[model samples]
Target chain A: MVRPAMSKEGQRPDPESDADHRAFANAAWSIPSYLLSGMAVYGGLGWLLDRWLGTSALLPIGVVVGLALALYLVYHRYGR
Target chain B: MSARQLLAAEGGNEFQAPGTEIFEWGPLWHGAPSWLTKPTLIVALSVIIVCGFFWAAFSKPKLVPRGVQNVGEVGYLFVRDQLARPLIGKDGDKWMPFLMSTFFFILVMNLMGVVPVMQLPAPSHIAFAIVPAAVVYVLMIFLSIKEQGLVGYFRNMMFPPGLPAWLYVILSPIELLSNIILRPFTHAVRLFANMFAGHLIIAFFATVAYWFLFEKLTPLGASLGLLGFVMTIIMTAFEIFVQALQAFIFTLLAASYIGGALHPDH
Candidate 1:
């Protein structure tokens, strides 16, 4: 039954509380950190695909997709 | 050429023209006397033009402000009251002029995207954003170090005394890292990325509109061309708001950074 604290003026309190700050920090970190990790994964996968397919053009596509996934994940959790 | 046709033919490349990258800095950089490209010239010109407008506007202040004077005053007062004073308080008394000038300077540059013929935002350049960001970064570090002695400042920033030991270990590094690194990076990147993305989007739609109207083969292409033009107009309005908002945000963040420096306790 923990409620997010509100300022006496009824504004949403600033993100300074240990819990609030932790939530924000974790959320922000997870987004960019995971996105970069996702990019690396896709980059590796794309390279493998290019080597197999002999097209050599899927690398950029994979990198972009990886980045997209990372951003999507970040966006999903940022507001909550 | 009419401005629109000229812009379209040149692909809105503001520098000398397409296919040439050489630039002449003249007295600005005496060493190089190269042929300047259109974008660079346009951007530099926009800066001069914007600065000139305010200079002229404020140079002769009337007892009752009129025309450009009124507009300039409004813009100036907006930054002074809403941004610099709120964050910096009494300390802002001296710095308000700097903050106000910087805010409007950036706003004018950002608004250039909406201006005809000069559709480029100067702050779209990393160097442009970096200049203001660097100012804030230096001010933040200076104030922090100055007000609290070097050790005291670092200790205050990294180790707030009230926090529990276990929490301190985890939170301190993050706080320190954010204050030291992420804040400035994000501060600059936020404006840079926003304007970059916005300009690119505008370029994409403009290209689509042009290609459809002039190069494509079908009636549908004509309709889509018009649609693109309409969207461009809509986006331009949004970009105006964004440009001003960004200018404000940059100033606010700068002031906040200064505030943090002045009063590290908060």
Candidate 2:
């Protein structure tokens, strides 16, 4: 929840708070970036593996690995 | 009761059409319904709900939060402190609201299936999931490229710091392709497929359960009905977990994408 305006005579929020909110919004760019990167990497691997192994399973395999890696990082961070 | 009569009772939860696919939207008229079928509608509605809820909470901001604001803070704080902050470190606070909104949006869309009137899971539709998945893809790639430079990012992602020459040759392409091409597609597909399959599972069991309980026209119907009823309940729980799990996975991956982008070497 947002804190009420701190001014006794109705002053504005500290510039820092506005800056902080702006920063949070900007961080959203990563959603598109990593997702694209991961897909490109994983899709390519799937294709390569499919060619080498003669199976369609490589794509799913790559997915499982990617998901695991992502989850691993989350767990590692929160584990603290 | 006859199977026809059993299924004809549309008001009941157990009712199902004989040949219809459960939850299948099969060609809406000539195409699909404009409001419900369009991916934009789903995404827009999700945003509205989340923003509206939060705005309501903060409309009259409070020093000591209460009710909805309190619940909202708990969710936001979890994302900010737990997921985003640690992953992005000091700069993490910047991404909290984005991550928070994304998590709730995806979670609600995923859970739509279990909600009685909203029988369809919006994320089950690839078009809806693809947008966010694509967003994550671009974010990760840009971070890597920005931090490591194109060549450096490629090297960092494809070739690890220490590996034997022979392994390098093998692992290089695998890692390159995996990190570059496949991640976003699968990320989208995973959510889409899970929701799709989930809807189907609910449909299948629901139809069978209904038939067993009411339509078979035999004493054995009662026994089959019990089995189906129990299964329906169990599957409902399973579906709920899957919905939540997919949301967590989506958000976690989104955060990790930022994490990897910020620290490609790690």
Candidate 2 lDDT, tens digit per residue, B73-121?
6676666655675555556667777788889999888877787756678
For model 1, how does the per-residue alpha-carbon lDDT over B155-238 read when each residue is reduced to its tens digit?
976675654678555445444555676667777888888877777667656755766676553686788788988988888888
Model 1 whole-model lDDT (C-alpha atoms): 0.65
Q: Which stretches of candidate 2 lie over 4 Å from their true place?
A: A1-80, B1-20, B26-43
Off by more than 4 A, model 1? A1-80, B1-43
Query: What local lDDT score does residue B258 receive in model 1, on the 0 to 100 scale?
Result: 73
Q: Candidate 2 docking category?
A: incorrect
C-alpha lDDT of residue B21 in model 1 = 14
TM-score of chain B of 1: 0.82
True contacts kept of 1: 0.00
